[model samples]
Target: MIKYIGSKRALLPWITGTIQSIHHQVPIRTVVDLFSGSARVGHALKAKGFYVISNDLMTYAYILAQALVEADARTYSQERVQPILDRLQSLPPRQGWFTQDYCEKARYFQPKNGARIEAIREGLETEAGGDPLLRAILLTSLMLAADRVDSTTGIQMAYLKRWAPRAHNDLHLDYPPLLNGPGQALQGDALEVAAHLEADLFYLDPPYNQHSYLGNYHVWETLVRWDKPQTYGVANKRKDVQERKSPFNSKREAREAMQTLLGRIQAQHLVVSFNNEGFFAAEEIEEMLRHWGFVRRLTRPHARYVGARIGIYNPRGEKVGRVSHTENHEYLFVATHSRRVYNALSDHTEALQLSLF
Candidate 1:
């Protein structure tokens, strides 16, 4: 998986274990992940025998979910995918929007890699034809490959002053660890989806702050969309970043948004993950969730993203600001009508042990 800032990679075991512990009380057959950013949580749940419905607004995120969550590996076997990836890897370098913007204007990837990315993306559009699954798998492979060679601190918001060591490495595409199951990857607003969708368990992990995922991963967005959009700024972000805003990103609006979303969601159970740096205080989230029945809270302290630890730097690459506290708490709120489900989550020993990571 890609190195995402708010990724549930470290918390996967804990999250999955907490859900599994509830099996004795209420069997969870289907799970709906509202903000399936990177599809990490959805994919993990799917592997554990739950039918996952992963939804995200971003095109890149939808593509990722389609490849990992929806598309079954048993159908798109490695034996078949490896040969396709090998051919894509050997495509002749061709300069395009990605090369001109992200490579030359900004230094996200080396020009050589950027050209290859452009070529492979274009090649796949023709090669995959009308096959959504094939298109998703190919794009997922390309996106992960680009992520490995990106010269940034795990985001597309800005590039490092000097190219990172990994930037020099040759770009290579690998088959994503796709799980075998029946799942759906949707592209739309979480609120819109919650209005119509019903599930056994709903996982909500909305954006905590002003930073938008589309802005942070704009390069990937452009790659997956393949719609050479109008870009601006040093990082070459899509113009749509300024236009497409989430209510959850607003401090004043987040509280109301969360409350409304909680009310709109039709689920027997809900598990929400929010960062300490988020708009709502831990108590505020607890208060909102309490209306649903019984709410159990689990807190885990973890290091902040690498960029925050790097401190603030000027345009000239000089460190100008001191770093604040280097860690934050991830609060997991579990709300369910079943007392047994609440009790199970409260005493999920395996989950607590997994959180030690």
Candidate 2:
């Protein structure tokens, strides 16, 4: 998986444990990840044998879901994927849009790697005959490989002036571990998607602040779209970045957006992941979720993302000495309509505490 801000990679165990605890009470056969950013959580759920519907508004994220969640395990065997990798590795270097912008201008990757990226992307589209699933898997491989060698601090908001050590490495791809089950990937607004979809469980992990994923990861979006978009600013971000704002990014609109989303979700169990730094306080979230059913709150201490760990840097990539908090409190709110389900969670909580002690 690519390095992502606010990714649930470290919290996977806790999240899965919470889901399993609820599953012991109410059978969770289907799960809908309303804001499946990188599809990490949805992929994990699929691997656990739950049918998952992964939804995200970003094209890169949708591709990730298609590769890891929707693509069956048997479809991407080593024999099938290795030849593609070899072809990509053998591609002749061409200085196209990627090499000119990301490599020469922005310094996100070396020119060699940038040329490889461009060649591979073109190959995936033309050679694969634009087959969406196959393209998704191949794109995911390129995305992850690019992530490993990117010069930025786990974000594409800006590139380092000098190339990072990893930027020197050659681009390579490996087969993604695809889950063996029925899954679907969708690209649309979370609120609209939640209204039409019904599942045994709904996982809400919307953007918590004004930093939209589109703006932060514009490079990946451009790569996925391959639009040769008109770019602006020092980061060379796509122009559409301003147009793709979400209501959840506004302080005034976030509460209402969440309220509307929660109201429309039709599910037996609702599990929401939020951070203390979000616009709405924990109490406000609990109150909103309580309207649906009994709400149980779980908290965990987490380290902040890479950029936050270092002192703040302005758009010019200069550290301004304004440091953000190193630690964050992650809150998981579980809402259930059945009293039996609530009691089951309570018993599981007690057992977990006893075992910990």
Candidate 3:
């Protein structure tokens, strides 16, 4: 499934390599995805038999972790879970704010069937908030279903300016599915999430922009939470905390935040994923590790789909432009724990002084 923002589809290759690099020295049984959006890294780790802990500040992401990554497939008796999705597909539309269906982010999906999505979302909340797995499954199905009915091409909601796509008539969840792993999903800050769980490796994919996740997919998540607060605009827009922001997303404070996060890390091997857009540079992460006394560093370069056709960041269609796609250009830094290496590395290295990682 295509996540709204900060997808890991492109980074799996690098992640796998990084994990394997540490595996030879020590078995990686536990994996923590600190800013677990879409739970892609956590899911991959789970599939590979690593215990996963998925954490995100957004409630929808927590639900995603419960439904798609952590739920034991066996816990689902077809009798219980099957009926939920079954009812979802057949449930008629309702007249709530979201029931009117407006293109959420992509300017995708005109309104006709988007209402069905709103109804399904509310229905699931009313029905399964207590049953984490069931609620998550139903919520995920709803998000996917909403995307199918929307008018945009990808997850961005700016709307397709040239020509809108047709909404799909038939969409349903595929259940009796296997979502097995030993994991827990927490909805909170990235740093706090780390304080609670320490795994063999911690994979951090935080919000690299100043924009909040709540503001980006507020409609979908609001419906998932089922509060349906005051909405605005030609399309239904949920009320959001305009000032709500992540430390990693801000321009002025991202550096200090990164510094705090790196220092507090308990995991032996750290793997951080970020493109050129984040507040800190690639060298900044490496320098942080080195200062913490890390020796070896491994960097990888790969192609990324920035904005040729996706990852739209602006409101007007005019804002679309080329994003950096360095051929074999992405970077992942891995460091091993060695007391000698730690002692050898300077508390004051000139290379570590640079803030551009």
**Highest-TM-score candidate:** 1
Q: Local error of candidate 2 at 53, Å?
A: 0.3
Compose the digit string of candidate 1's lDDT tens values, residues 1-357: 887998989888778877787765788898999999999999999999999999999999999999999999888889988888988889999998779999999999999999999889888977787889989999999989999999988887899999999999989999888888679999999988889898999999999999999999998899888888999887889999999999999988888888889999998899999978999889989999988899988888888889989986666899987998899998888899998787777568545766576
Write the residue-wise lDDT of candidate 3 on 1-357 in tens digits. Answer: 544556767667557645754664567887778888777777777777778888888887887888767787667656667777887767786645554445343344555465566566667766675877777877776776665655554444345565444464544555624465456777788776666677778877767768666766665667567775666553345556454667877878888887788777788777777766666677776777686456444444444433344544454556555654534345555555755433333332223323223
Worst 10-residue lDDT window, candidate 2? 348-357
* Colliding residue pairs in candidate 2: none
TM-score against truth, every candidate:
0.97, 0.96, 0.82
> Cα RMSDs of all predictions?
1.3, 1.7, 5.9
- Rank all candidate structures by their TM-score, best first, as comma-separated numbers: 1, 2, 3
Instruction: Supply the TM-score for candidate 1.
Output: 0.97
lDDT (tens digit, per residue) of candidate 2 on 231-346:
88888889999887899998879888999999899999999999999997889899998877699888778889887887667756577877658999998888999888887887
lDDT (CA) for every model shown? 0.89, 0.87, 0.64
Candidate 1: which stretches are off by over 4 Å? Answer: 349-357
Residue 39 lDDT, candidate 1, scale 0-100 = 94
